[model samples]
Target: MVMVKFLGSLISVDEAVNKATRAFKDLVELRIIEKTVWDALYYVSAEDILALIDQPRYDRSAVDGYAVISSDTTGASPTNPAILRVKGYMSPSSTPEEYVVRNGEAVELATGAPLPLGADAVVMYEDTNRVGDEVEIYKPVPSGANVSRKGEDYRKGEVLVKKNTLLKPWHLSIIASTGINSVKVYEKLRIGVIGTGSELVEPGYKLSSGQIYNSTSVLVKNYVETLGLAKGKYYGVFPDEKEVLREALFKALRENHLVITTGGTGVSDEDVIRDIVDEYGEWVFRGVAMRPGRPTSAAIINDKPVFLLSGYPVAAWTGLEAIVSPTIYSILGLEKPVKPVVQGILARRVPNTVGYRSYIRVTTRIGPGNKVIVEPYMLKGSGILSSLVKTNGYIILYENIEGYEKGSIVDVILY
Candidate 1:
């Protein structure tokens, strides 16, 4: 193993994601999956679905009526009804009876029954009188009136589903209706989360004077699951020891497609993650040009990705949203996930440092004239976990932009 110093040049969010995507471009595999197991899997279709057998497959009645040709009911009136002989009955069933209506005849049928071969329209029974095997029509009908034509819903050779579609329940229904029982989809990427710090204790354990409960593992796990990008497993916390951390990293790399660690990548002497990465892996990038999550780093070991995030809750979250999530989706060839946002007026002015992309947490309320007013949370420390709970979302200040004025409108990305 060779040691390499951390690269201090900070890249933009998009550049970081592109680099990560290039690294894992060929990492995921495609598998043939049955419809039964595709309920909630994140996947992209492997090929184009060019056709579907005609929907409904036949012309059927849209209402309960007598099937007749349009011309047969010509000049029909209440004073002098057009009389016709009743042919037969047609019902909607697995084995429907066949009945043909000639020029001077009509067939009685229920709603959704296939139209007889010679009928071009349907007249409701309300407009007719039944006397023995004859019926008197009182009104006229046009061709295709009250008829569900063949291929009305969908046609054969029509595109059923496109390639790279994220399958939903309705999408599955459509595919099933076309008689497709299995499909090829990109497999989900597996993620392993680990929290690191000597002073950190697992939740439910009594903390000593200098100890804090572990939250990053659970937070990262929940984030991964909620995004539907990958399945995540928590590996608890690792201390500031090189050998233990190295062993844990190796184990995680072997077990998962990607590994994420919270903490121990900063410049302080106690931060050992950077050192371990240099000694045991290859660095893709060591830092990003973003506030709060400046210590974020990425590496590859044994052909698996590893993301080192800040121990601070807010910074860890930012890293996941800004970098990790996009990379995962890119590798899977899925569209980038977008957070819901609303435009609002800033309640106060905010300052920012040049060349750093800043994320400011804010709470929103309805203002005068029904306008949304955003109030920035004053506490800006990345470690303040409660700030995240107090705010609904954050507004991003671009790297080149300084900040926004008190009344300026901005987009707030929701959590």
Candidate 2:
């Protein structure tokens, strides 16, 4: 007979986090790996990335115009324009030595061209009427106008990218600006991802009447990889049979720093991972008091973390997002990345269970006066993956909160 119980006591999300990460303040010592800047995308930097050279290296024109002495165009305007003789033509390829703007003279230079000596400003072509060698400057420009100064972006040895950063495209460009080709980044945390349940089958194969696709494995694997903290090694679906999952659990724990198992949780006969955790591992938490993924859990086995998540897609997502991600960040001594939040007026009343922290998916639309309107999808189901798919972001109803009424402003964290 199946018995329903929390072998390890249920706890709040915050308490679970405390329990899991309390002993791991100085736990980080991951190996650093060198990667080409091109391949460093998404990897966390292990060292401070410094700029070797100044951006631009020299002052350059910011627009295609006539480089001029700022004093020559003083008080110049459309009615009483300053007429200067064009001294020479200069492109970005031209060296500053190739041209010089003396008194009453201007050099026709393209955008990004090196600013010629004796020229303190650039008057855009649109503001100048050029006829033959003479150009009428209708706009007076101050010194340094329309010019990018040397060392304006970065000076040598300045921090371009800080250590432990998730490197993005702009970070790579900044590094590339200083002619850097390689970066030192932390090696990926290897995680073993396992899916459990006799009814689960991999996609591309026939699903019998009692079977569903093992999408949790795919979701967990991809999500873990996408976070850039870890690379997932998938161990395929296993049945509810205790000995089989027991062997897979031990083997995976031996090979990875973290092991995540989906499906074998909750108070059911088929939820065997919880039993394995109780018998052979120490539970950080067996349950969390949250909606969708109440059975989300964590344990330490063989000196590594093992997270137990739900089988239902959306619930599994909540388990990973709400509990797993924060736990990982805590253990690694990394700050959790903040999600973009947008505030909107509620379109309808959305109530939450008093003690449960609820995650409500929402679709936002621009209303009158450019105001954002949030409509909560009230179809409450832990298994409702489609609800998440149809929404752009979600709102959290904290444990202390009850709900939001119509027209109440709410903050939505973008997915």
Candidate 3:
């Protein structure tokens, strides 16, 4: 029921988050258990993995190619090739018998064969012509040519990635090369999502004249799932009646670590979540100084954080970012999630509100001279979902800033 302000009582986003974080002060003992490598794809962590290992490891080659010394082929060219007599071939899986590459001799090497004594390079068969016992090298192979040195891709004791990193395929490859069988990652938090509105109905169900499709429930669920941070449990659609919404919120708060409710945080009479939460729980903070998401609400109910987010898709997303995400991060003991930010020139003028920070969707790419050029997406209303789909990300307008002029450098957080 409280509308947060900035002047005497209003706090900036940074200050607000800081205060909220300090208020908690490690109140929750939730330890997001570390998952194995196989589970890393589904869950991200708040800790870096590189800080765990202490060893030098290398991935052996998986190919078959000659490993030879390089200095012997310097003057060898395609026109006047250098010829070296075939000494012998070494196969992998068996210890290689040491054979010195005398100036005019080429020792055959299987893929992954360690460089023989006195050999520094390997020339592929395609680049050489063989006549009887002698091979003609057409290209000048440089020293260390075609060689994957010890720990070229990874080194001993090198922290591949820090804790709290989302494991990608490339990250898996790096650790796999280091002979790491499993990894530690934070466990995914469970989220309970409740949607409340008498005018709302589930998409597949038959709807009456006054009922609209339930968009908030589905959108909130999808957003939570997409981040790999939490699994959402929908409590179905409830009516705007205080008793109905209150019961749903109560159940959600009890069952999950985080409860996110969409569509009932606005100022309209239909909005009942704020009043209900205020009656049942202590309000951490309410309202924010951001456009399209001003009606955001936060509270701690029965020891669990409850977020009553705005019904507008963008507003809901912002509310989640401003309130819910920080709680999730703290619960999992993970670093703050950062949106991809880049600097670009504004393609046109963008007016701003004086007291509120505005986030505008934008399309950006590297234009002439490799400079980033960002054009603001034309859609401005909180109701337009297509605008977000069309844009790559958002550009921020500070609370005190009036507007942005064309050609001005702006920072954009890419989608």
Candidate 4:
């Protein structure tokens, strides 16, 4: 077997990702569309949302108590209580015109009730006693106490949500507080996943001795869906032949907003996907300086992105996450999906090449004395899919780091 040389110098993972994803930044601005706040979850906001009005809308009671002229309750105590006439009651739906408080008067107000026009503070019910037609405040209450002032939460012109925000349930609530039922968001981009190995077969089908079931498509598709920025469409596997792969690539690109092809990215003679991409588009990067995904490549044809990923499941996943995912976040102005991380002591030493970034799968356990211990599954297995399944999280050894020593504290990113 003849060994193959890299097409050019390897680029840092960061630079490779920038080139692969940011090339199509122009397309994101065009995808702005209106969606109901309920349907906008996970979609990137297209514009800054300014509050239409003050958040409280009006001064509101923060407790179930008596809305009163705060000065009337001044100097009141258990032995010498201030007495005030009970003007009326106010519920959350009560109109201010009906329950206005006057001098030495109070209105019984429930929590969230709009403060009566003349009331300056609320004396909680527990601190007052109700008499025939008057209430006695046992404690002095200051002005603005227990009152949610108008515009306190958000000013009328303040930004409720910034442009390119990933809308969450709380974001929807804030938008709703502004009386906005719909929001402008970038529509979910369409991504096509195509496989290019002749030896690949569909799952559940009888495979020949040399053939393996295609798993990269499943990996890429679900990953895109979970990432929430794009909708993945799989265009069935194709042969490595140039004509077949070319047709497949064109069809997938035309049908989807972007395309990522698995397999046919190696340096071998049969790796003709690179040739097809070079013939039609400009190469963004031929390879990334990372282990398990050194063959990762990307190109842009007519402003559309096409990522070439390895057929190996782990490598394909790494390429999608390390490159494709970050690019989507950076170019579209969406926050990247943050993985939960834990701090733990390394169970064993893990080595890495100085120039390559490595993602080491690991499982953690609570060892003696409640110490969190991280166990790396394997240090070198690009094609071993089971390693990912057995591991619950991963620790990233950056390009400059050689390795981690056992018993050293490290951060683990839990999937």
Provide TM-scores for the models: 0.81, 0.93, 0.82, 0.91
Question: Model 3 — TM-score against the truth?
Answer: 0.82
Q: What is the C-alpha lDDT profile of model 2 across 125-241, one tens digit per residue?
A: 999999899999999999999999988999988999998788889999899889999999988788899999999999999989978998878989988887877889998899999
Each model's Cα RMSD: 4.7, 2.1, 4.1, 2.4
Model 1 error, position 218 (Å) = 1.0
lDDT of 4 by residue, 1-415 (tens): 9596788899999989777666767754446899998899978788999999997878999999999999998899999999999988889888667776889899999998999998999999999999999999999989999999988999999999999788888998999989999999988888999998889999999999999999988898888888776889998899879998888788888878888889988778888887887788888898898877888988887567888898999998889878888887777766676889999999999998998998888999999999999999964567898878888998999989899999989999998
Error of 3 at 307 (Å): 1.8
Stretches of candidate 1 off by over 4 Å are 1-7, 28-40, 50-52, 60-149
Compose the digit string of candidate 1's lDDT tens values, residues 64-107. Answer: 98899889999999998988888888887622237767899998
Clashes of 3: 21
The digit string of per-residue lDDT tens for model 3 on 237-335 reads 888899877777788877777778888775566777767866878777777778777767667777776777777777887666665667566655567
lDDT accuracy of residue 95 in candidate 3: 43
Instruction: For candidate 1, give the lDDT of residue 56.
Output: 70
On the 0 to 100 scale, the lDDT of residue 270 in model 1 is 69
Tell me which residue pairs clash in candidate 4.
Answer: none
Candidate 1 residue 55 Cα shift, in angstroms, is 1.6
Question: Residue 80 lDDT in model 4?
Answer: 96
Residue 96 deviation, candidate 1, in Å? Answer: 7.8
lDDT over C-alpha atoms for residue 56 of model 2: 81
Q: Clashing residue pairs, candidate 2?
A: none
**Residue pairs with backbone overlap in model 1:** none
- Compared with the true structure, model 1 gives a TM-score of 0.81
